[model samples]
Target: MKLQQQKYRLKLCQPAILPLAVLTALTASPILADETDAEKEKARVIEVIEVTATRQTENLQRVPIAVTALSGAELEQYQIQNLGQLEALVPNLNLHVGDAANAVVYIRGVGQLDSISFNDPGVGIYLDDVYLGRVQGAFLDVVDPQQIEVLRGPQGTLYGRNTIGGAVKFTSARPSETTEGYVSVLAGNYQQRGVKASLTGPLIDEQLAGRFAIAKSSRDGFSFNQYTGKNDYDKDSLTWRGSLLFTPVSEFTAYLVLDGSNQNPDYSRTPHRETPIYSLPSGDFLPVGEDPFVVNANFNDREELRTKGVALTLDYQLQQSTLKSITAYREMNYRTHLDLDGTPDASFGIYSYEDQDQLSQELQWLYRSESLSLVSGLFYFRENSWSLGGAIAPDFFVPLGNGVFFPFPVISAGLRDQTNTSYAVYSNMSWQLSEPLSITLGARWTSEKKQVSNSGEEFFGTGIDTPQGMQAVFGTGIGHSLTGYDASQRWNDFSPRAVLNYQYSSQTMLYSSVSKGFKSGGFNGRLTSFAQPYDPETLWSYEAGAKSLLLNQQLRLNTAFFYNDYKNFQLSRFSIDPDTGAFLSLFENSGKATTYGAELELQALLTDSLTLNMNLGYLNGGYDKLIGDFEQEVSDERELVNAPRWNGRLGLDYWFDLGSRGTLSVNAGASFKSKTYLTVSSSDLLAQPGFTLYDLYVNWQSQDERWQLNLFGKNLTDKRYRQHGFDLSASPGVQLGYYGDPRTYGLQLTYRYF
Candidate 1:
């Protein structure tokens, strides 16, 4: 249903419309929990084994690194699907601001903050060695996987660039040369429904093998928009993979992997989260019937996104070592028109973003031994993007005689053109001084550049009172409203790293490291007051950590402390271009800050049939000086915003052997997130507060490795919660944080052809 002209004033409708739409559709994140005996057989042996910490695959206890590993089994048992579920499995990790589908991942109390750009991320995401640039881009096409590893601390060593906040690596299930595949369907509350299946095995006997899979899910938004008539959100996805492994001789072999996926979601909304009339505050979960903000007036809205990519890898092994190479190309396009109607638009009419990311690269490496091993590689990346948005549309706030939306000074198109390129060479070496002592050394040199130009119309706001600042925003709209400003910068950086590792025993290890991390420079896509380019953000990191096994291998514990010195950090600022009411994103390199924190985790086999795990994280981070003299800068210094001060989680896993062929294994977990400021730069501390959430899951399997079943519950108590939000000032529009939904439950079943 179209929002009524009588209720939604122009300014009000401008901002809230898009945000509510997107937030609502994205509320649907992948969720599933079920297993058969064949799956159980694999799950029972070990939860997961990780290799991200060192490029070497070893038991979690033996790896000389600070790491958190989530097995495919653990992923399901907890019904922890996607990055959001990770809050409960990994220590000190939180997805603040945005919903489960769009997130800013934080680690060690420090992570990429306000780091949304066309070509950068404070942290890097790798899918088989191919980097996923934008943090938002990393959220889509999420697949039910084999395992995921969150490696903390500075990985400046051999992981490559943009890893200051560490890295997250996902390894999808590979094709088995000896067997085929299977399929499954799932149904749950909130109108959640899904279908998925895959196939693999011999195409030409022992000479070749391949696999392909597909999945789709949809659900009604927990935040109902009565004005829209339809439930607020839904997500649809599809993926495919094909592989060919060949062994021509006893000592020579090669493997090829081609895979990609697509995801479309229509969500974003606000349903009077809670009532001051009753509860009176922002952090509580309540049904629409019992709340105050549930009025049909305001809603979040956004139009589109499509992400797809393909990756290929080749591996060759000798008697004692392995060598590999990877090549990839991926593209993503996002086109959105947001009408921040309803709640509070302050008057900036429709704001929009139309951009696409096209990336390609070739990576090479070698690894032959665990001790006395060396790794080196080369990389190149390039991307192009465009955007059309502003507050210049005079049609906004203007009374609509009919049902047509007339922005104040419509900027039919706002464009920013940019080309980003980086070239790098890196090397890492390790040697064992003794069985108990080892030393690691690594270094990388990079040359990077970015050039940006603007070609479009300026609406009117005069950079003084708009999100883009006053001078550039608009009061009237017409012609090429943009100044053709272009800039290019070059950087040469040498990152050096060293690590000392000691094996106290077969069950324990200790390690310490020192390294430097870098995030390359980029053009400020938003309108800017100064003509200068933004400097690259850099970090010098120091860390010490330990891993150990206790109680006869019944428990595992890991912890780390880090001190980070950051300079010229890139921070996002919002202001209206005087020419338009639309918020203009401007950048300044004068940003500097320090982040220090601790991460601790423990997993215990409580009994012969029960086990438990707990994770905790803390951060003391903020800036030390004035970044610049912009109104937006005043708002940016508050607690570095999304980096919450505290985070923790608890998990319990239990298995009971039923009579004979039946067994019941139950896994449940709960997570706690401290009060977080979606827009930490805001002046009042009361604007944002701490919140807590809980979840649960269970699984049943036959004694054999063939049949399995899983039952799960998310937001089990229907805990009302908001993950992230934005409120643009000046004819300002307030897009409330996306809220976590009510109780959702489901059951899944699987069988294997082994």
Candidate 2:
């Protein structure tokens, strides 16, 4: 590690305010830039931010949509490492991590809370222009990114299906014509250490360029298991990306991107601190633990995830339009061993392993002229996935004779294979009817086919604790054999949109739109009997919004109000089967639901030295009607999972000249989230109380902008909060919660080489 070489010179107890003293001393020198240029730059707070929200590059202020754009510099200044922290900066956005491979995302009270292989997220995630087919490995770390864009609302017209909520787009920094890159090192508490380096430059003069970047980070866990004498949430990960840009002709360009990551970590969750409300099946009471970050598991739990992807993009510039093609392939392998009950005596556990592969191709033509602009595209996607898992009982429960214990799984074991193929054709057009007004129309036609194959066995018999019991469950011996199932289904849909935009002036615009979105239906292979495919989910969204820059470009404010009518909403739940009195995974279609919300974003240069940014979101979400399989109506007043009534952030950024030596910048933010439930089947055990988190950072840059030193603290108040929660009442009194990180402070040193 590079830090080892420099460790001797650094003191361990340096004051947190030492950076400020250094900045004060440097301020005695002359200013780096002229006064006029500085004044002009400070006044233009709007800063011509750009985005591809409309499938075309345009200024954010000029785009008639609800969008937020963040630059790489901005993300670094805020010390955001992954998508999970992004919720603090964007309204109505929630990101939860179940493991290194699975990221559950929600936008505007709409999202997929479950990480089931058969289901898809309502919000689409894209890298560059390639859509990610699965949530696995979606919570990728930031790596030399150029920009991140979030479009709030149904983007189905341009992005296709599964975008009823919204979309997130990430664009990486490209290789420059000249040699340029940076190297950074960070050290923090909990044995935290990380290294990130990137190199980009011309490989063949004006025709070709290449870029390569790599990042490695590791951190010790905070949660400790006394019985096992091991930490439960340790992390170790490495990620690398390489890209090449080829320009063989004056009007044509091709780019190839390859990226991969490997992660190994301990268990992701520990037992909840709240006492169990139900009695244990063993007639034992829940253990008492005053510390929130402690558990009593005795099993050996491990997790490993590997992901790789390749993408090729080509663009051709014609006389009147630009044609683009994208081809992508991705694969992931995820494996985990989990202790479900968290007690020293593990009543339940699981070993789950899954392998997935996906491929996609898309071609589009974009044309823009004086009075008309249009985008038309064709997209195709295919995916193959397989899962093998086993549910097991504790070794102590079924001990063998002669100091031995059963080695095989106890309850159930299964293997499942799934495949999906989808195709779509979409077009969006805008026509200028008047000097300051335009009407936009868009539609998408999609067809999809899905297939599922499942085979599994259940061990049942008195004294069935050995390999013979497994054979009996498979019917190879004396027990009843579980029947295997194979099924396929096809679906088609047409989603459409209409928008009206009025350009009040160059600095302001108003827009209103109505759009439709859809998600494909699939089979739930986990079920053992009479498994049926769920119906597709659909939603129609109506929204009105405004974007404006006021006070001589010193203040920017954007707001939007939206309402969605949803039908056949897909929901996943763990429910008790009346006949068996056992919990089972169930996928169902809710009859109807509705969500209405409003969002406000503001960016203002309160003074030349101080800036303010704020985001506020208010959501009202509930079911119009729903009936569970229990022959009873689920209450209509239940709020959506992960949907808080109120969520917002307030940020302050200040920068001052460190004179000729450098510049100093300081930023602080406070984020608040109201109480939220983690699952649609809201339970007292699944609810997360509202909490507030604060972050602070200070950066000092060298005069030439080649060196930067950053001091940062996250969750400064050391608030303990839950990122996710699960109700295992089926096991009688078991509740598990995945916790957010604790107060962490770190310093980073970065040097640019060009």
Candidate 3:
């Protein structure tokens, strides 16, 4: 059956070769027909992108940092809907869905795997300049965005702590004076359906303007569950945003934004890949299959996620400076249930729930002069979060002689509460030293405090179905209520950055920089006993890069090389408690490591109607030392987690004019990644082999620009690959792997109202 499916996919791809060949031929010939010098010059000019990566508005090519900026139009053209879709467009970035509630993100081989409230994300996600405190809510939907900027390497100096990896900023579209709006509808395979709409207009003439956008989408599951006769890994979500811009006077403005999302989807399906023999009470062992999208589970798994946030931004423009203030509040509630064993025997299962809220305030002052630019800010953030849930193994059994067995059901419950607060002050200054040379200096001092309380109980005996049932068999049960522990810790650090930039020519720039990054330490939230707190992790990075525009602005090329000296790398591990014989998750600091890499990005307008773009990345280096209990198991020979040795993307887009009727566009792209390890131990069961994916899109628009249509196909070849994995063979006797989405084709239609 799998072979037949492969053959069918090959038949579907044969039609794409002709169009690709035509595009290639066009790239080698002149695209403009008998045009004057002025017309040709206008056709070759690339759009000038503006970015705020350095805390001030400036041309993207002039920034002394490694950054990738994508405009709203470009995002739409690429069909990017969320943060997970951005990995293919950027170099050295990796993102995937770890579970229903966690979106794992990695940049330049640095990120956090655990999503518990006590642990902070290594990569910072910012929405409209407001930082998201938890990784559980970082998988944001892109709704009416104005721009998205991905800054590579460490951003500790300006973004503050927990940014040792990098930072991603999503800037939403603000209210506009002109009245305009659009509505779009889409349909695809697997019962996929979606609708999106947006509107922007003035409420009080030139004084007040309001904008609103909403998106709702639903799709059938990707995997089939034989036990329940239902589909798994489905999608159902609704997201919306509203904003009001008040310009009381010409010099002052206040913007208030509100956003929310609700996602209720079927549980993620992690099918068994390789399984060890586990005899059931019936004297038979469960059999595992090769199919990745089929599961046999006894539990009806599900997940629910709801989030809301509000932010107010105030800006006051002075003669030579601007003062700004941002106040924001956000909250999230997430719950999920899983059948970890992926078998009908119901050997092991788990449920988790988390509730979190955060409040933040920031003030900034910007000063710009003829030869000098300065930006300074004060930031304060606080968060309160808690989690309550447990695991169950009601059908667990231990065998005796002569085919006899005894029920050994295991039930466990736990609760953890935590509070975090942070304060920081930062400043960045840039001065032009000569006609083509400039220097920049920045620094930030941050202090953070974390407090946590944990309590739990585990029972091992017969007739232990739930936590309440434990009391009935208290005397007979072999378990005890764990002693609760409360702890607090404080840490402070100073991160600094220095850069030198030289404008070699009007369209070329060269830069070199040195920066330091830091991530705070905290107690493990999933502990059965009191343990020492892990120490903080720090890194020093040195980088050099160049940005250039060639062929009279028709081509843009950027390249960078970086080396990092890492210390006290925080690593997560699972081990069995010697006292209680219970499995526990904990963190320990590894000794030292180093990483060096290089990246290249190119965008060229081969002709007036043809464009080509590519991005390539190469990474090397691993741990130089090891420590702790798992040292013998985890060796330095393993590659870094989510860090592929080589990754790249290539794309081509061409436009065709249809006289006065309409215009059509076609785009083709392919992305490839080398092998990657998903776990710190680099287990072979959790490693993803190298793979390549292809995509194609066709678009048409009416000459009046009021109607548009798009037909798109993703993963065109129906390639099979793993997005995430877990090695639970030691406990559950099953290796679980989550597969990526298969081939999907859809059509979208849009109508504009003005």
RMSD (CA, angstroms), candidate 1: 11.0
Ranking by lDDT: 3, 2, 1
lDDT of each: 0.59, 0.76, 0.77
- Better structure of 1 and 3 per TM-score: 3
- Reference-based TM-score, model 2: 0.92
Which parts of model 1 have CA positions greater than 4 angstroms off? Answer: 1-48, 96-101, 113-116, 250-253, 266-302, 319-321, 341-346, 349-359, 369-371, 391-412, 458-480, 528-532, 576-584, 626-637, 683-688, 730-735
Better of 2 and 3 by lDDT: 3
Model 2 stretches with alpha carbons more than 4 Å out: 1-34, 37-44, 271-273, 277-283, 394-409, 459-481
Query: Could you tell me every candidate's TM-score relative to the true structure?
Result: 0.82, 0.92, 0.91
Estimate the overall C-alpha local distance difference test score of candidate 2.
Answer: 0.76
Which numbered prediction scores highest in lDDT against the true structure?
Answer: 3
Per-residue lDDT of candidate 3, residues 459-503 (tens digit): 754446554464344334356655468899999999998999999
Q: By summed lDDT, which 10 consecutive residues of candidate 1 come out lowest?
A: 5-14
Supply the TM-score for candidate 3: 0.91
lDDT of 2 by residue, 1-754 (tens): 0011111111111114556577566655666665576665654455667788998888887777788888777767776677777888888888767633478888887788767577777888888777877787787787778888888888877873447788988888888889998988887777778898999999999999999999998888878888778777787999999999999898999999999999887655555445543212454355557676887765437678899999999999998799999999999888776666666654566666778999999889999998999988998999999876656663323223343323333566666789999999999999999988999999999999999887776664434543324434454544344657888999999999999999998878899999998898988767745557898888899999999888877788899999999889888766665664455777888678888999999988777667788999998878888776575687554667888989999988766665466677667889999998876667655587899998887777776778887888888899988777666554334566767888888877888887
